[model samples]
Target: MGREAVIVGVGDLPLNGGRIVGGGSILQVQARAAKAALDDARIPMSDVDGLLVAGLWGVPGPGLLPSVTLGEYLGIHPRFADSTNIGGAAFEAHVAHAAMAIEMGYCDVALIVYGSNQKSERSRTLGGRPPILTMQFENVWGIPQPVGGYALAARRHMHEFGTTEEQLAEIAVATRGWAALNPAATMRDPITIDDVMNSTPISDPLKLLDCCLVTDGAGAIVMTTADNARAHGSTITHIRGYGEAHTHWSIGAMPDLARLTAAEMASRRAFEMAGITHDAIDLVECYDSFTITVLMTLEALGFCKPGEGGAFVSGQRTAPGGEFPMNTNGGGLSYCHPGMYGIFLLIEAVRQLRGEAGARQVQNVETALVHGTGGTLSSGATVILANN
Candidate 1:
């Protein structure tokens, strides 16, 4: 928190049929989002001296350096460049990195960009094992990818805390309720707990409705020094605090199956840095890869005690008019989930803080908390933003 970093611009491409309309590659959508961000900031590409790009899910060829590729594509000679690949939490981590870079005088203006064509490329089943993950034991035992890993966690939570399937269904139902208010949501129809329970079961205790949507989309954000943002005449959201933590990569290696330890550590650091309690937050933009993810995150973030997430979200507390408005833009469950969902969380949080979230807007939003979980709940990052 040396020199304050503020987000001056945010942009999101229109999600269409799990694809970017007009037949564009992952780079094309990324460029489009980047251009939109630049336009929103009223800053020329020449002014951007830093670049960070998330690794695309369905790139045509194997590339080791995504940030370099993007910088070359965008024709920007950035003084600072980074390609941090922590799955869904990458974007949030990028924000932190960009802030530090600006504070340390590594760069003045930084652009963080992400885009994915997972659905269009039929790459929905892309979460296998990363090169860093050498343990193939789970694969040999037929663990059925992320759905099965998350199902195992969900089942354990149910056993340890008496978290019922109905409680889990409540999360999906409430999120869909919010989605109904969002015009860009993929599935806007209101659903019930019965609808969730009756839906197709992907894994044991996790119905199809419990799972997040698979759609193609892109999002971007521009970060710079607070003085720079003010000089540009931009309505900026200050990055008050941020933190990150990682426990393990593989599900088999996870020390605790019933909880997300990283969320606890990261959120604590963020809250302490921001000097605010859970009650001080007006809204939460949590990465909802699945219904259980949101539930576990709420518990880990101290909104409720461990094992109390079921009761916390039971009566639509996270829905439109709930006491705690969470995932107000439908979240990954109903909103677009194009592989990595961290960027969208930032986008929604920024919109809410700016009072630009029409319909789904949370009233009198002074501060918002955004968190992301990546790689089978292996990694986590928390960011606190305030309009003041």
Candidate 2:
């Protein structure tokens, strides 16, 4: 029999309000999320044979061996451990890694976890200079933080593809509409294109509303062999296929300003591996670090032509009752975006596949595409999940 992996459980920690004062540390948040996942799966902590943790770059602690430290803290010595830090896409990559590990007889069960107190501890300065070698050259140019980098991409996309700021606002408005259905979302108030345009401008082509919220949050997911998932009597979301790709690290080093080639490569590979076409996907859960990110991702993922993202998202195509239901959990733009938003993407995908999305649920979702973008559109990971 061929080996296969299935997600047996998923859990999300409570999101702290934006810039809130008091909240648990990263370790505490991760532990709680892990416990929740274990409980949800009806599995004991000792049953987890693999552990994968997302590393926070600037945060203090066991910098070199974050996964080992987290394992020790959680009191579960796993046979397999990984700490692959590719920015926000780390979690999605971890899912791929965990599935491969399980298929290779390295582990029977795996737990992928992430947690961050960026809003409470760091005041949401996640994209600050990291004292890296690239910063020496890039910082001198006075790049306008992360927002500025995204604005540059937005500008280039607009110039080449005729993408407008109003089109970008459509993404935020549609995502916010989903937020209104989610009580846990940070920004539930519905927004319009005019409201997004009138909001405070953080960058030339990007407004405050276009940016994702800064909040402290954590999430975890449990993946096990398909047979084990059946034994647990849990809602099984099968890992049909996955693929990852990366381009440049720094925004200045990006080869193309208007396009995210990594997303294109990743999504194409995932769809091919899953043996499905773009039209077969019932829903999408993509990282929305900014409105531009979502738009560019849609184009790169083959939802539309290279320069047709603006028109593809027009007329509230991604909103509730729209043809393409996306970001049904409000996305990072309206929900909580800690340092890493990839884990939340998996959580929401699982919810939608399990038919647990409540008011925002898409009817009869059999397949979902979860994509994550990290860095300044530098890295991308795509996972195709199905409920069988």
**All models: lDDT?**
0.88, 0.88
lDDT of 2: 0.88
Can you tell me which runs of candidate 1 are displaced by over 4 Å? 58-62, 127-133
Per residue, candidate 2 scores C-alpha lDDT tens digits across 1-388 of 5778889889987654553234677677788889988888887889998999976733564846778888988999899998988889988899999999999989999999988777777646645676579877777777767778889999999999899999999999999999999877889988899999999988888999999988878889999988887888877888888999999887888889899998998898899899999888999999999999999999999999999999999999999999999999999999888878999999999999989989999998999999999988989999999997
In candidate 1, residue 23 scores what lDDT?
50
Which residue pairs in candidate 2 have backbone atoms (N, alpha carbon, C) closer than 3 angstroms, thus clashing? none
RMSD of each: 1.6, 1.6
